[model samples]
Target chain A: EAGVAQSPRYKIIEKRQSVAFWCNPISGHATLYWYQQILGQGPKLLIQFQNNGVVDDSQLPKDRFSAERLKGVDSTLKIQPAKLEDSAVYLCASSLGSRGGSPQPQHFGDGTRLSIL
Target chain B: AQSVAQPEDQVNVAEGNPLTVKCTYSVSGNPYLFWYVQYPNRGLQFLLKYITGDNLVKGSYGFEAEFNKSQTSFHLKKPSALVSDSALYFCAVRDGATGGFKTIFGAGTRPFVKA
Candidate 1:
């Protein structure tokens, strides 16, 4: 089975520029997530989507960060007017679903590394 | 609110020696604990998780974590450290009662296994 796929493994942009990262999750996975990981910090949940509907996005910076999981398959996370603090890795993950009591481990993609000048 | 803490910023160990990375969590109800490892410039990889288990949960790369409810701790351990195992480790937790299922992660700990 193919792992989660992410485009533009590395990206560099100036501060205040807009950037977007795309992710294609593993086939048959129903849950998709986007996370931001700063240097020396763990990945933080930016948004979560259960199919096309969002399940949680409390941590997302609505003022600048936005994500969409259209068609319940692939996802895109966009950061407009990126700041210096936004220079970090963006990780995407997916799981089977939430219906079963079993806890499905999240499979992650290689992630896109963003560097803001 | 749920949170996780990794006490050590970095841990150094020699090959064939035991290695441990400490983690503690705070949650309102039963917690779902998890451990993830990240290599250089890579995404976080799931190692193991503890969700209503026998307290000792073994995971990939010969790693295991002990879930202690009383101490609110879930420490990752490997009996014999391997040089290839050097990487960043993160601890995470989720609240079970609310079904919110949003994970809270710790400030990662970097493990350096020397040859």
Candidate 2:
């Protein structure tokens, strides 16, 4: 099976500009997530989606960041008026499900490296 | 809330020698632990996880982790290290009670294996 796929492996934009990253989760996966990984830090969850509905997005900066998973297969994360701190790797991951029985290990894609000038 | 900690910023080992990376977790109830590896310019890859049953969980690339409930620790280990094993490793945990299923990750530990 194909693994999680992400586009625009690298991105560069000036501060205050807007940018967007895309993700395509593995087929049949019910859970999808977006994370940010700053240099020297672990990936931090930005948002999570179960099917087409958002499960959690508390960590997401509503003023500048937004994400959507239409039809439950693919997702897009956007950052408007980007700040210097937003310069980091944007990672997308997916898991089978998030139910009670058993937790599936999340599979990740090669993230898009975002640079703010 | 659930959290994880990787005590070591970096670990260095000679090829063919044993290696260990330390991790500790805090959670209210039973915890599900995971280990992931990230290569240069690559996304994090799942290494192993400890959900239940066994204390020793083996994962990809000859890596294994020992889960200790008493100590609240899950340390990654390998009998023999290879140069290619060098990478950034992260430990993560989630609380089973909440059913929230959000994973919290550690700062991460970089491993360097010398030939």
Candidate 3:
């Protein structure tokens, strides 16, 4: 199966500008996740989608960060008025879905490297 | 909430030498653990996981991890390091008891294999 696909491998924007990242999960994957990884830090979960509906977004900065996974296939993560601290890599990952009370390991994409100028 | 920790920022070992990257986790109940590797400019790849059954779980690329419940640690180990194995390793944990099923990742540890 093809791995998760993300667009615009690199992006650079001025502070306060808005940007959006796209992600297409592997075919048949029902669980999708968006993560933000800063330099010298591990990836941090921004949102999770179990099918088309959201299962978790507690860590997402609702004021500036928003994500939508319509039809449970493709997702878009948008950062409005991006901040300097938002400079990081945006990663997309998918899993085979949680079954029998167990969650599977996620397969990740190369990710979008974003730079705030 | 579940969490993972990688104490070392980086580990250096010579090629063909044994390598071990330390990881520790915290969870309210049974912990679901995972090990992932990330190459430069690439996404994280799953190397292995520990759900249950055994304290030692072997994974891809000749890697294995030992889950020590008493120590609250699940450390990644490789008998012989290779230059290709040099990359960032991340440890993750999920608390099954928490219906949310959210996974928390630790700060990554970079492994450098000197040839």
Candidate 4:
């Protein structure tokens, strides 16, 4: 099986600009997640999707960050009016889906390294 | 709120020596614990997980973790470490009772193995 795929291995832009990162999950996966990893810290959940419907987004910066997983397959995360603090690695992951309340391990893509100037 | 913690920022050991990375977690319900490895400029790779069976779980790359319920810890251990095993290790946890099934990761521990 192919691993999760992400585009634009690297990105650089000035503050206030807009950027988007794309991700393709593994085949048959029904759960997708977006995470932001800052320097010297762990990856924080930005959003989570079960199929096409959102399961969680409480940690997402709705004012600036937006994400969607259309058709329950691929996902895209957008950051508008990016701030200097927004510079970090954006990771996308997928899992085999939760069954009977048991969570499965997630498969991750290489991730997009975004830099804000 | 559920959380995970890796108390050590880094661990150093010589090749052929045993290595251990400490991890502790807190959650309201039964914990689903996991260990992941991340190389430089790469995404996190799943190494092992402890859902419910034995307290000691074996994983990839000759790694194993002991789940101590009383201690609320899941520490990764590998005997006869190799230089290639040196990398950043992350411990994660999820509360089984939580509806979202969200996973929380620790700060991560970097292990440096020298030959």
Query: Model 1's CAPRI class?
Result: medium
lDDT of 3 by residue, A18-65 (tens): 999999999999999999999989999999998999989999999999
User: A24-71, model 2: which lDDT tens digit per residue?
Assistant: 999999899999999989999999999999999999999999999999
RMSD (Å) per prediction = 1.1, 0.9, 0.8, 0.8
Give the poorly placed runs of model 1, Cα more than 4 Å off.
none
Give interface RMSD, per candidate.
1.1, 0.7, 0.6, 0.6
Q: Give the least accurate 10-residue stretch of model 1 chain A, judged by summed lDDT.
A: A96-105
> TM-score-based ranking, best first?
4, 3, 2, 1
Candidate 2 has an interface RMSD (Å) of 0.7
TM-score of chain B of 1: 0.97
| Alpha-carbon lDDT of model 3 | 0.94
Which pairs clash in model 3?
none
Clashes of 3: 0
Rank order (by DockQ, best first):
3, 2, 4, 1
User: B12-108, model 1: which lDDT tens digit per residue?
Assistant: 9999999999999999989988999988878789999998859999999999999999999999999999999999999989888777868888999
Clashing pairs in 1: none
Q: How does model 3 score by TM-score?
A: 0.98
Q: Whole-model lDDT for model 2 versus the true structure?
A: 0.94
Tens digits of per-residue lDDT for model 1, A2-111: 99999889999999999999999999999999999888888899998998999999999999998998799999999998999999999999998654565577899999
- Ranked by lDDT, the better of candidates 3 and 4 is 4
Alpha-carbon runs more than 4 Å astray in model 2 = none
